[model samples]
Target: MLHTVNKSPFDSHSLQTCLGLAKAGSDILLIEDAVYAAMSGTAVTSMVESAMNSSTIYALEPDLKARGIGSEKMISGINLVGYDGFVELAVTNDKVQSWL
Candidate 1:
């Protein structure tokens, strides 16, 4: 499955909730404000790191750049994807779930 989370972890638990229930080997795509979770050293960094153990995590590159989070600032294991990559992930997964 592919999980897409667009909310900021700072203001929403949707990211955490998604991570908690995500299937093993699924992919999690962070879009919009949720890209903040991809950065290292944040309050939710541990959660993000933990999720990486079970899931392949990614952040939308354009979204991260818009929020002033460069690829260099993201957590080491997180992958950065553009619009095309996002579409690719969506197609690769068996299903797509968007966390509000």
Candidate 2:
């Protein structure tokens, strides 16, 4: 499954809920403000790291750049993807569950 989270962890529990319900081996695509959770020093860092153990995590590059978050600011192992990559992921996965 491809789980897309667009809410900021600092503002909502949607990311946490997605991480909790996402099965092992699922793909997590962080978009919009959710990219904040993938930053190195955020409060949700530990939770993101924990989720990494069971899921392949990704973040939208455009969204990160829009928020002034560079690739260097991202946590280790979280892949950065462009819009095409996002489309590829969507096509690759059987389903997409968006956490609004």
For every model in order, what is the number of clashing pairs?
A: 0, 0
* lDDT tens per residue, model 2, 28-66: 999999999989988889999999999999999999999
Model 2 worst lDDT window (10 residues): 65-74
Query: Mind giving the per-residue lDDT tens digits that candidate 1 earns over 1-100?
Result: 9999999999999998998899899999999999999998889999899889999999999999898997678889899899999999988897999998
How many clashes in candidate 1? 0
lDDT of 2 at 37: 92
TM-score of each: 0.96, 0.97
- Residue 64's lDDT within candidate 2 is 94
Clashing pairs in 2: none
Candidate 1, residue 79: Cα displacement in angstroms equals 0.4
Worst 10 residues of 1 by lDDT: 69-78
Error of 1 at 65 (Å): 0.6
